[model samples]
Target: MNFSGKIEYWEQSTNGTWSLFAVNPSDNFSVYNFCGKFGSCNLNDNKLPCKCLPGFMPHVPQKWYSGDFSDGCTKNLMSCGDTFLNLKMMNIGRKPEQSHQVGNETECKELCLKNCDCSYTYDEKSCLIWTQELVNLQEEYVEGYNLSIRVAISDIEPTVQNCEPCGTNMIPYPLSTSSNCGDPMYFSFNCNTTSGQVSFKALGGTYRVASIYQNTSKFFIQVMDVGSLRLNQSLPFNLTTPRNSSSNVSSRVTDDVEIVWEPPLEPLCNLPADCKD
Candidate 1:
């Protein structure tokens, strides 16, 4: 049972989402003390199976042993700056079969440095952004796609990589609540605090929405009646957030989100924190 190996599980990056299982036995993966615990690894693996990103390091090392590496690594003792990129299970041997073989790893960095719009780079593919925001960042194995994050110059050795945040896509949103039905009806929204991109869906059915507000990374709504809620004629719509690793979109409202749903009123207002009706 000493089967071990690092498998590429591209959950978010490219390919929509393809799950790859680690612990390859036929592939010659060896046995290690604790492997594949961080991502999807096995107990027996030769390489550094589980590891934190550049800006991050091991959190609870003991928990990491059992594979509970959720609280991966904390930010390194360096401020946000530039640092040489670090390459892991990349070009050396792994890559997406459906990926476009652009070039070598060096070429990847060359591309990132070439475009000012490029917010972040990974998988040997440069995410050339016409706009800002590098959202939806996930980890996986790809040929020639080792990513060295833009850490504080203090993180890496003097001769290593260097980088800094463009500070463009870090948007913010505020929450708010309003009341309508004679102190009984309430409305509120919270921006989804997810990076890169996100899809927003209205909770209730058709309701008369009066506003689709946006504040920093928060979404505000001033709907009228509880008949039909929509971004426009569309009930239960979706709002895809930006594609930045550090982006959040939440629905906000005033103390009691001022909601004027038509027809049958609503239930969210039942909570005392929401309304008094």
Candidate 2:
């Protein structure tokens, strides 16, 4: 079925019956899904499918509420430092004006920050940076790359000093043993020694501190099984399981699981900071 502003394309299903492919200009499909610049489209939101990106507000609130987002959004506030907010599983439908082959994501971020024209940066196998206004951005539930959006420094909170050790595990500076030690939301750690094994109090199971990456604000943890992975509160970090060197379960079961936690791209402290945390 086709209409003046919408199209319903059909496709053959695996069972050999014609099925509805998609409906353009509806919730699922559109040529300009997000409506305008700096707008993000989400099909899950029925009433308001389009939303302004972080640090941004609707350019015209009345137009936006009336289901007309042609004007898009503008920045709400400005801050001191250069920061980028991560938008996961988003489809930004445009090629970046410039691209670079960097060593890693960290390097890619640094390069983007140095260039004032760069507005967005993406990292997969290579790094791609965009200088133009972002348009037609759509969110997907699964299978997408992370797009880091640049913002100001005043928006970010500073980190606190909270480096302490529980047993043999040394909790890093940003990670504290108590509530008063580190940044309350971003850098808090709990240590439990009741079981004679050192473990993160927030994380239920016992784990051994393997290594800490201060520059990246990340840490490696060794545990017996992957099932024990749990965090007491939500923080701006990505937890991933690293590959085990040994395949023998009996020989290396206790040391099989390795968890790597990565902080956000933005620094929790001011520039020229030390690696103590």
Candidate 1, residues 179-262, lDDT tens digits: the string is 222112112322222211112235544221222222322332333332344343332223343221211111231111222222
The prediction achieving the highest TM-score against the true structure is: 2
Model 2, range 144-170, lDDT digits (tens) per residue? 456776765333223335343342233
TM-score (all chains, Cα) for each model: 0.27, 0.48
lDDT of 1: 0.32
**Candidate 1 backbone clash number:** 74
Model 2 error, position 25 (Å): 4.1
Instruction: Report, for every candidate in turn, its global Cα lDDT versus the true structure.
Output: 0.32, 0.57
Evaluated at residue 268, the lDDT of candidate 2 is 47
